[model samples]
Target chain A: MKTIAALCLWEERIAPRYDRSQKVLVVHLDHGKAVEASTIAVEHLDREELCKTLIAMKINTLICGGVVDPCRRTLEQAGVKIIDNVIGSPQAVLSRHLAGALSSGTVVD
Target chain B: MKRLQTPIPPELILDHLAVGVFTVDPDFLITSFNAQAEELTGFTRKEALGRRCYEIFRADMCFEGHCALRRAMDSKSSIVRERANILDKRNQERPVEISAAVLRDKTGAIIGGVETIQDDSNRAALEKQVKASYSFGDVIGKSPAMQTLFEALPVLSATDSTMLILGETGTGKGLTARAAHNASPRREGPFVKVNCAALPAPLLESELFGYRKGAFTDARSDKPGMFELAHGGTIFLDEIGEMDIGLQAKLLQVLEDKEFYPLGGVRPVKADARVIASTNRDLASMVREKRFRDDLYYRLQVAQLELPPLRERREDIPLLAARFLQEQGALEGHTARGLSSAALKLLMEYGFPGNVRELRNILEYAAALKPGGRIEPADMPRYLLRIDCPPAGAQRAAAAETAPQSDSTPDPTPERSETERKAVTDALHQAKGSRSETARLLGISRTTLWRKMKQLGLGW
Candidate 1:
């Protein structure tokens, strides 16, 4: 199925904390193949507003590290599936996700 | 004093301290993350070192430019005992008392800054418990609006005028009415509450005025109505707008003549009971639509008290939530101390359609769900997520309440943001760019005022 996923970002690695991430990498996938990608700077938005923005973008999944409950609960309630505590470069994480091997609390070598 | 030849390792001592201590370089990258800091931020020293400080301390102040460490570095001084919040690894918000100071090299060159964060969750919860004593009877509020209501309460309670309490459902109209009765001169007399909407027209009349013996098949003996029972006290007519027109006319008669006759008796009994009517409905609109009697509306309006909805008085949310957590948590035998900062923020952002009652219900549910610590966001009712964020006006108001001042130039956009921007710009000009004074004039926090100004492009 076609889907959109957002990975919370810090430089080249996945941010260790979802609420603190200043940027996000959004990727569009078609049948497990990446089709498009873009980066969003979110330093100006608060946690709640950031959640709203993700929902507004119709993101189907979220990949990140530790997520505070408020944002996690809110995003999940909005139907955005969260893959939390996943650590790695955004590209490596996306590759694992596409391979159906990524799981919660995955740590990259 | 003589200095010891061998000195204790400062890093070891810092690691042993109860408070979390971390240091960041001039570029704001972490240089040292002590043991307590590791536990609090949920990051190992290996992972935390070399990362940006803001990434570890995802505090509201950090995003809003109220960072204590930043302020300390800029001022070349120490910031002692300031309260702030940071999100832990699991995204739970932890309240902390922070102190920050610039770190200098042995050569006296400014190097970086060190911050110490002491968890204050326990102390904060304890402080809230102490505030529970400030509540006026069962009703609790410290907002100016509530204070005004409190100031007017004694005078209203002293008089016998028919009082109309107006508010949205669950905004404590019932409680306010009860407080009025308890505070009145007729405290010894019974305080009767009648739900006008709960009964049919025929039964409602009999329930209000009561019936004499043999009046109906079920009427075995003469019975006193609520008004009669509350002879020298008060009768709280809840949802008064729902009363039938015929019953309303009879009520109007009682208000006018101070007497009501039994269902089948010729003799009229004096009804000295003070009447306090309450409704969530707009009685004025009801009168205009011929759904409610104008005369009855005016009678109840003689002494009106409109309770502000919980959203309008956001300042009271923390106190009310804390109070409910204590009262309900104790009843449930739960160990929940208080709500986390994120949970409290959620409560504040939600527009409580059900008002204070909804807040209490939320807390009761949270108290039951939370294990043995501060109530975190996950502990709150899941349905709270379904509630939409409050209107933009409210959001703007809230933003203004948290913002700090800035010296940046304005960057106006052609977007439809004139009203709010102009207000902030004018206020800032009047206050001579003093953020605190401008915030005071706008009835918001300097942080909030700064945020609004930033959002509206009033301040860069």
Candidate 2:
């Protein structure tokens, strides 16, 4: 059983793009967790609210297209594991995360 | 040759010079007049000969009835360079400079005076031209804020990097963005603008990334979005805070990839557009609330520029007002006379809540009321004239009473405010009460959030 978050591109279902402020979806999984997932919108939330909401939701990982420097530092300080630059459907990206096959490169584009 | 040397007549000597000349006896009667003087007055020398100089010129004598002739008589010396205005037979006023000398007999006894009057009409016309040329462009001030902005503009213009402009609504953010775009390498490229707050999410999405033919029910034909149209150009997103969460994420992707898929389109299109976003709202706060995407915020904020509000740069009001006046005057075809010293003082003392925009509006309104007239304090708006000068004691008492309540009342915070409070709490909770991390998630400087928490007495 593993829970992973995937921040996907809205227009392209094939590949997901990272959010500018590094926001992603928390995908709950345990072989069969009904594919239930929730997105974290960090566009308006400051660092404090963003961290608090994620922790309250008990998200294990954050997958976003892009992460701002301040939020990246704050998330790293909170001991959150970041798997960035993952684009696609939540289900497809979650499979890669579970199989330990996600790229760790920072997506700035 | 030595036989007949007739003494040159004084009248003949005076009549030939181009300058007007006239003389009055001690009796104040016109005694001598030259041809130029006759031409200037529209009267022949024969008609003006016996009339009083004041009667011929239609001019009141000096304050003490002391004309140039009277001065020569009193001092028994020549009175040179005396200036006055004279009225001709037709009552046309003329400015004249006069020179007079006392006529003395062999015994050195004082007599009537000989006065020379020269027209100064050309000099007056030249003075008028000089005054007209001194206008708004002459407004000068050396404030640190202005100096800093001027120095920063060149550097900001050199790059095509995304700029995040932060300032109050009327603080000339749009102007600054235009200046930066105009100065940049993209000067020749199209400069597109989108007001994030003015349009709804669906329209904004379509506007930014054009939809394909039959993309939606109303889709008629292929249209280029701002991203495509502004390719090789700059796009300004104003009030970026109002954009929806989904759009924010999409925008973030576009920034990251420099590519986007039009709505309902199969292919991804590459966009080579520079982004410049501006907002009065606190994006960092929105980020913390999970309303704004954190990643997008960072991408858009590569180079941040913050403008001071009008209140912060009050010294620029006079310069801004003068510029506005000249612009309005030129458009309206009137002389742009500047404000009186008192009016300038009043403007400096008032706080401009609407910033530079409001100042322009005020000047335009004033100009409409009194075109080409000197702007006195009375000409200012009624509200500005009645500004409350609060007593120091009252202000201190008010601050003391109001300051504690905001921190004391932690109960029943309204929905939006409470949501903001909750958002802060959530960020703090996830960060394990780490203020610095919380500030980052909140998208605000640590100092600002620190002050907010301290004011609310929300002990972490």
Candidate 3:
């Protein structure tokens, strides 16, 4: 099962309206696979919108820098898992997610 | 050069003086003693005149050591305002302030010393009483842990830092918090407490942060919250882990900024009260599981104090039991008696999962049940007696009662314990084997459940 999907804000900033253009990222995980989707940019998105996007994609896992209650609740309602709040490259978070050793909701800063 | 002078009566002059005056020779012998001196020493001049001052007075001071009269005579100068102890004829030692001056003749040669004494024993007694009254009494515990706790109390009492007291239900966490408050600089201020788990989220919030008029259905008038009431004092948050996650965030914000808004009010009110939070739950585990907030956990853990469980400190059981008996007996208007050695032994041997609280409840039950007499092992609860017996009989009885009656054929099982074992194993696997949570779900005390788990060798 793809248990987690990464949302990269750095990529969205360089590519204008990147979220609207490509709403989902499908990645293979160790135990499974995951689909990540969001209507708003990862950096500018509030917790609720982020949660809605994750729910829409049927994704239960996420990796992001900062999150608020709306995003937390939406993800929780969708049974989506959140990994450590990653600050660096999104690829590192994806790697940890594949290893199944990643601790969720941990502030990585 | 003949001048005839009128003689003045020394007795008349001495009798009218207020100060206790006496004359001592170079050998420290009492010579001329005035009426006041005789009254002060509880001796007549006739009895004191020829005796040594030390022998007559028997003061704590000796003539062989530092005597003000001797120093005054030796130096041929006034030795004024010296403090010492003096013994009266009745053998009562009194603190006396003495002023000794060297008596000189017309040629300026030192003759004897004249000393004045004033009793100061009353002042000394008053000082002693003040010192004795400041000690915190009746709070008994001499163990090293308690001693260290008492020693650290002053430091805790001196500050306004948030304190977290972690202990089982009956370890007197509430009492400790009160003690800390009473010992602190805010002793005169209010000590308010809120049971976080007892109230619903909305009510708990309104109770904590106050509410404006017409804020809710029953909130007809503006009422001050515990925070407002506890201004310049302390607010104890009990069972803090049970507080709702949403309120936890608000509480965290208030702790960080020392300001909170009322339920409906727009203006922020500054909170000056110190916070003391307590819980028996494994909060770190809760945080790890995301049941509790991490930021709130760190904020409340400024100065953490963990109280050891009653079973861990069984030495205090007897004392606590005795105190409880006395308290309960006093309240009930009955004579408090000691517990039988066997009963006490039973209590000490039993592992109390509820901690001090459980012990107290047991004692209260025993006290209530014992018909105006001493408590014995038989007087204890039935569950206590069952601890020694294995669960095989109960398990068989339960299985026999619950088994299907109209089964076509009875397949012989090894034993009911085997079935119970299998059921427990399945439950553990289904619950992801979280022992603490399993204990909660199984409707058994953690200690009892843990014992069962250990017996079944249910490893994490």
Candidate 4:
């Protein structure tokens, strides 16, 4: 089955605060090849709603910068894998994640 | 007689004052420390000098983004009498009132900052005495109803039984749920909360129990729901009465079997989450009306807690009002001291239909409308003015009717403002018309004393 990942994007790099991120980038992969991508505008929703949005999108993985305990726990409990505290451009993180080089709590500035 | 002509040092002058005074450079490094500052902070001048002010005084706001000296320097203005707490050398918390101003060198260039600190233990104790014991996490209430709730929280938080909370809108249903999660053994786990009424049935269903990649166009990959995410923790369902009838059956299945199937998944996911549900509507009535399922309602009611509305707990009004005022003042950089007696009376008399949330909004409005100093009755929102509180004229008429027969004698019960004005005038007279001296005696800021004198039409 193909995997989908969502990255909390600020401008070019990941957002500093996961709960207050306004933009989310969802990427779809088939056999490790990029198939489709979408940008979701999530400024209207709060932290809880943001989690629900990721779940609804069937996003199995989430990549972002700093995430607080409550938000990280909620995402983890939902069975979605999170690689947080990553500090890099969305493209770099996505590439790293695809290569399986990205690990949770690694700061890839 | 030959008089000894010796000039008193500047440090000696500052040391003789009752209040603690200190100076800090633009970088927040301690520059000069008076004797009183040394005594209050338990740090000598030798130890305090050349060190960061926070390293010595260790005020709560020093590293909390509310440093008075930093604010003064940034704004190039004076912060008149803001209350803060500091930790001394022994790590004892000492409440203090801080006033700071930007210091300028020759040629009008900003140099450093000067701050004065006064011990506020007596004042803080009195204010705490007024509020009594009304604190639990973020929940604030002093009424018997809230007390009962507080007493039951510890025991309820220890168990994972399905618990139902009944309360009106804005009555702190969510706060209580969070408090339970924070106090529970599973506090390390996630607390997932969903407002059942916030989303439509389709979206809510997907949100609660996720779907497979091909279940829908948006579902590009398998996803998990709030229940799965709340494993070993808690899931708060707010406005549970608004949940869809069909969804309620599915929820009951999860509660019974401790497992639930995703929308398109063939396998059932284990549900390790504890359920905490809340509703504003009467579930019994909803069950009778066929809007709510009887079985689901019974399952949720295994442990029930009914939160009392703010109107029912009137005794907590003053405390809540004061707390809100202080919070607003701190956030907005205003000096909101307190409320006028008339304003407090108005707040007490008005029945808050929207409960504590409404009270918070009301105070926010009053804080903006108030020109300066304490909030007055006139500062309240116009909507609150429409509420049928007893008018001042009615009180005067009632007083007149109840008074014993007298030949045009003066009324004995004076208004609070009048008494305050008389006290200010007397203090000013005793201080020989020095506003600063009067403020020190009255335990207020010189700015406040000046404002009072001007408002009261005192010639001085």
Using DockQ as the measure, the top candidate is 1
Question: Per-prediction TM-score, chain A only?
Answer: 0.95, 0.59, 0.58, 0.90
The best candidate by lDDT is 1
Write one digit per residue (lDDT tens) for candidate 3, span B1-460: 7675976698788777977888887776688888877777767787678665654444444422677787788777887777777656543556877888888789987778888877777877887665433322333454556656666766876788899988665567888788889888898999999989778998899999999988888889988899999999999998898899999999999999999999888798999999999987778977987988999999889888877766566677787788878888876768768799999988888665455566676777678788458999887755555443223344333222222221332433445446445544654553477766444433234554555555446664
Residue B187 shift from truth in candidate 2, angstroms: 0.3
Tell me the TM-score that candidate 3 gets on chain A alone: 0.58
Candidate 4, residue B70: the lDDT equals: 90
DockQ of 4: 0.02
lDDT per model, in order? Answer: 0.79, 0.67, 0.66, 0.78
Number of the predicted model whose TM-score against the real structure is largest = 4
What would the per-residue lDDT of candidate 4 be over residues B1-460, giving only the tens digit for each residue? 8776997899999999999999999888789999989888877898778776765666767635798999999999999999998766543668999999999988889889999999999999999865544665567888899988887887898998998999766678889899888888889999999989778998899899989889877789998899989999999999898899999999999999999999888889999999999987778977987888999999999989998877678898998888888888877777767899998988888655456776787787678777357888888765456434343443233222221222333433445346446556765665677877565544343544565565456765
Candidate 1 chain B TM? 0.57
CAPRI class of candidate 4:
incorrect
Residue pairs clashing, model 4: A77-B229, A78-B229
Over the stretch B228-315, how does candidate 1's per-residue lDDT look in tens digits? 8888889999889779898999999999999989898889999999999998777897798888899999988999998887878989
| TM-score quality measure for candidate 4 | 0.50
Worst 10 residues of 3 chain B by lDDT: B398-407
TM-score of chain B of each: 0.57, 0.56, 0.56, 0.60
Q: Give the residue spans of candidate 4 off by over 4 A.
A: A1-109, B1-133, B389-460
Error of 2 at B20 (Å): 33
Would you give me the overall lDDT of model 2? 0.67
